[model samples]
Target chain A: MHLLPKKKKKPSREPYREISPGSKPVKWIYLSIMLWFMGRAIQAAARVDKTVKAEFDALPEGFAFSLGVFPDGPYMVLGKNIHGQVKSLGRRGQEQALDVRITIKNIEAAILLFTFQESTAISTSRDRLIVDGDLSQACAVIRILDIVEVYLLPKIIARLAVKRYPTWPMTQKMIGRIRIYFRAVLGY
Target chain B: MDTKEINIIQHRQPGIVESLPYNYEFYNPVKICSGKKAMAHIPFELAAINAVRPLVLASDSPIGRRAIKLLTNAFKESEMSFYVCDDVPDNADAETVRRLTTLYLEKNHDAIIVAGDGAAVDIAKVIRLMVAEKTDDLEQFEGEIKLSHAPAPLITLQTFDGSGLEASGWATVCNQTFFSAQLAPQICIIDPRMIIPMDIKTTWARAMVSLTQAVEVYMAADRNPVAINYASTAIQSIRKNLAPVFSNWVSNKKRLALINAYTAAACAFSNNQPGPGFLLGKAMAQMGNLNLGTAMGIILPYVMTQYMRKTNCDLADLLRPLSSDDDYAGTTSSLRGKKAIRCLYDLQWTWHQAGRRKIPLTLKDAAVGRYLFPDIIETALKNGLPVFDETDCETVLEHAWEAKPLNVTS
Candidate 1:
């Protein structure tokens, strides 16, 4: 019904915008230092804390796990030695064929876990983490983390971070806490 | 009525009453993550299921775009990557699904992240199915429990409006119905940032369906204690949040509570069959004129009363969620059913007033004449739920025609 020839105009096209993923440098730095302390603390706890030693004993020898943020990480790698000792392998665990890789999805989620804002159980349930290997080993590692947390933080903060606080005698708690702290900080 | 007719109704009544609720099943695979940072957890959820690159299907509307933006922001620090195809068409036709499926295969997307209502989600689910089965025969995929193996991990982000099946293990792609618990999203993220203000009609209609579906599942004969817990939570949340949610001022917390109710209701419904109310609503929507939620809303009270009078359905438990605990406990068991049904009437009226009387109170008010009643019933029968017969359907229709949910019986 148009009297004149219809004219068609090409539609305008907008340029695509790329969404680049961001990094939290401050959180990564903070988490790196904390992971270092915790990695050493786990090695120290297995020597001093009988419960941690028993947990490590239950795991197969050479059981190694990487726990921290993915890609670039403030990560801790722990492995059981052939001599029945647990050792902190620093971040070099990624290079080894680890039994488990427990990764916090991001640095903020790691902050939530390390700052005692969220418990290990709560963080796992909330899906702030990813466990990529043998689930049984991942669960055991989580237990080790919980035990080490009790030694590192005060009872009030430790109680918030662990599912159930252990009923240790006042002396055992006091003595173990001191020994674990002394060995963890001094690397003795 | 003839003796034969009376016997059939009488026979069905006891069958429902004697159903062994003690021996039933309840299952839902979707893990709901709600709060401000819920979107940020999607990467972890996808990673937990071994999905690295997900195909993002979202609506192209402004609200959908805003939601996609908010969702993209959550992935900033997670080291995960996904491609966004926000140009999801409205119809979600087979052509679109096929195109997207080819695109998905071409791009090698590992999973699906659907960030809108039914259309986008439907396309994503169908695409997931085609890719999982590695076939183009969608027709053969129809029916219940068809998927033999779980597909790639799919996560859905609810933008406060959906087809009610978005979170359920059901998908209607190009009129072919597919059902499987595996088809349901592994994670349902309901962030407050995605709660957009929608039309009042759509708002209350969705609310009404949530309320009715909760009651329907709670009253189902094969209902389990776990499903009842979910249904009860939905009902209680709907009852408490309906008023404030409809007020002029917008409250994300209040609406988020309703969204949680919808999730609970969908979970409960997925565990059970489609109730008579839902079936008829679906039929009305299929007629091409009515909104499914609005249709369910209009007929819900009448259907509840019908079930109360005909079947030995125990509705006294519904009193707890319909009203206060004091009101529920104070009422005698015999009167609690009627009180609960009466409470639905009051609740519907609240929506009616809030919508400025534009919300239909009866079939006639909806401009759906009695002539269309038989067609709706016939279409409902095709749903094949075994929950309603012709007579029961007619009875509900007649009562709804007159807006008399409680007029017949005391």
Candidate 2:
């Protein structure tokens, strides 16, 4: 049987990428991106043991996310911060309060998800995400970064990003790449 | 320069059991060892192939493991190319065999050095059959047949007990279903070192099967001098060697005795036909889950006694090898036949004394009160056994049911 080499750990650094907040309408896009990656990372490290409270405290202000562990486990709760404001069209609009509550369980296995969304504003919206490998390792990393790039982000966002960019094939290639990563991480 | 065209194919040596193809050609070297680490004499066919192509050594047992390493080292020193089929499971399925065949085709291995017991040897045989016949159902090809076409040269290393395959162009296996021989191995290797690891129970069982084959042949209506000689040698070996070995495992003399019994048995069946003992052993082994050797051991003396009663006394000359001992030298022919019954009883006693559970002595004991005479006889008739017609069979079954000892009749 063939085996792959392990990756070398790099020095600690700040978040590599982040979706910046824009107008009131753009706020939904930024929150959705954060929710998507965070969800993938949580599912990826589904086997890891971490304090849910600490995870909730580490998230960026104004954004709330919930972590659910299928059956039974303590979840980190994040409350909405009324201090942040979103501008609608060109002018500042009233701040909308958001409450996020998540329930976490200890179901440590791989779960694959694929979804496609279409809107008049976006050209395409097909997205594929595969989360597998060691749950503990992923959980620890999620705690540290407070944000995950979601390598699958391109396919998910491509369908919603550029109007002309092809998403179907890219989604497939991305899913394959994710599968390879899971195999490498899990050493299957 | 005229170069010979060579085609190589991979074949699996399953540890459990397998069947062969009908169209395949088979060749057995006539010498095979039975036991844990059985070794066969490389056939002239294999040697002929060896001069031109490479021979791979294959096995998965601890004994086979050691042999593979030793064989590989020897081959490397002698400058031979080889491959070992050690990845597959002991009882391989059809898919696994196909995979092995493909690998062989890809690598172009000329032939194989098969080590292990009946399973390993038969697995290789089936592979050859598959290649030749283009089919894998061995049942379709069951029965006596001639194989004039030689398959890929395969050298079998035997380490268990069974004479049928060694003697005839056939192999039998149970892969959830029963299957029989269509082709034999091209070559066979027999080495006693392999038989040493066999437990007493299995050794006795295999010995019985071999012994029964020999005796049955001697009693067959078509009995020939050649078969009688083989059967006599097989019987004597069992009486002398198997008994002593069964008593003491560490004795070299006992080991030799055991191997001799195996050799005699294999030689007895090298021909396609089998006698009463062989049929009875096969039937019990199949129907009662009894070890073939034990079934034969238990039934042999009885079958012989039945034959002796209806025939002349001089027929006892067939056991001359065993009769030479001082303990048996002066015994009359009729008395000698009685000893056959005594010997089986002693075997049962020895098993109990040795802490091995005593097998049920008769059909009633074997079936736990279930009547099997009708069923056994029915199958026997279908299979063309001439030893007992319906009336004679009923009498034999009645005698067996009571575990009665057969003695000389005036």
Candidate 3:
């Protein structure tokens, strides 16, 4: 009698499961902070650095572009205003028009670029980034990104991030890095 | 073996392989990278084609996501930042295809990397077709396969679940059939990490489809030795691997072997016209809304028997790949074809039992009645199977429905 089959238990059914879009919140916040500083730094660097000033002079007046992740962005829009200065517009709203847009595909790819894990040249070549705008203007924006990356990161890391590291005098490199960091923090 | 007798034609430039009538016209241009760390070699393949930007399309299932993670890890040490759209719909809605097209064009994606099987692979092939050929409307080319030039570089990363034709020159996009040798994948990467462990039903369908392809190539009307070599190897590999996998004694190596067989079978079947068993399987799958592999598996034995009755070629050769050394030798020459058919039926019986009768062994078992049989014939006619006709399709389907072998002797 004890060896007889026991009553069958009902199998608990699992609720419906779906794939959620994998997003990294910490990285998003990190990229946002970095872009904010980088924006101010570029605006400041354009005024102080002679090389950046020359690149801006070559650009057509009112040339604007935003570099950020697609769908959701923590971007810094840089443009040549009528006053003949580079202003880092922190996170351009949809209402603001742009002439060029450089988009990184995802947060993971963005982290790779921001963390100096992959160089800008490598990212573009590997198709991790997309440029939607005038080709020549986009190229100029990329050049600006390379110059700014060199200023933000250390020599060893900066060398890896840029295609061809510039041969600058020690004083110029040190002085430029200091001035950019100073202006970026001072809200110049 | 004379030089004058064999004029070997080589493609002067990459991406074009020419097949000639004279001698052994053997051609499979797909550069396959298999075994361990095969996924790591994808970057090198991309470099060879001068494609820096690749848009990855993958299924959104858990297994598909896992495959993406593996692919992502493989590109870890490299500087490549390939874009991925992992949310591809399973049924391949037109909107998803159009949206991906916009993304591909906007981003200037140079090549395509398709991860996962079925709809994801189909969309990747169709996307490449539309972009490369500049075809705005795919509906115009329905029913007939068309291509003037090879599409952009496509690399398919698939699991064990597939029609086994994902890497072939065939695509079933939005229920429309398209075929061109140029549509085949340029780089077919088979990594063990991509293998997903599935139930008996899924395995049965996939293995059955692989078997049909190899069998048709091995027993084609116009025999080509090179193609037969490919089919023979696949059959033997399937025989060695399928049992261990199906009996719940699964391993990574066995899974890789089955995938290898699928690729090998595709190489052989791509060049030849699909056989009665292959064509009938396609038709039956459509008619009954059945898994392509399941439908093929159900019709294989009966179709094999009927194919023997008509071809009257020595069916004894099939036994060699399907059976072991001692058992094949024990079976006498006269009874070899009969023994081979028995072996196929035995395999089917085993599948039916293992599936707890969930795997159908006959058309009736699959809930497909004779009322739908005419639809299969029309589909076969649409495919224009060379050695098949309406009557032949009906005869195979009739026996396949009853779970009985054709009793006619040549």
True contacts kept of each: 0.20, 0.00, 0.00
Fnat for model 2?
0.00
lDDT minimum window of 10 residues, candidate 3 chain B? B11-20
Residue-by-residue lDDT tens digits, candidate 2, B276-375: 5666556656666666665666666666666666565334444354455453556654566566556556755665455355444565655522365677
Off by over 4 Å in 3: A1-188, B1-24, B143-146, B247-249, B325-335, B353-357, B408-410
Residues B84-180 of candidate 3 have per-residue lDDT tens digits of 7777888876677777777788888899888877678888888888887776677777654667666888998867887788767878877787877
**CA lDDT of each prediction against the hidden true structure:** 0.79, 0.47, 0.77
On TM-score, who's better, 1 or 3? 1
Candidate 3 or 1, higher lDDT: 1
Worst window of 10 by summed lDDT in candidate 1 chain B: B11-20
What count of clashes does model 3 give?
0
Q: Score the docking of each candidate (DockQ).
A: 0.16, 0.00, 0.02
Across residues A52-156, which tens digit of lDDT does each residue of candidate 3 receive? 888888888898889886545767788889988998765963446888888775566778889988888888876667787888888877788788878888889
Who wins the DockQ comparison?
1
Q: State the interface C-alpha RMSD of candidate 3.
A: 13.9
Give the winner by lDDT: 1
Candidate 1 lDDT over B296-354, as tens digits, reads 88888888887876776658777778887788768876788889888889988876887
Clashes in predicted model 1:
0
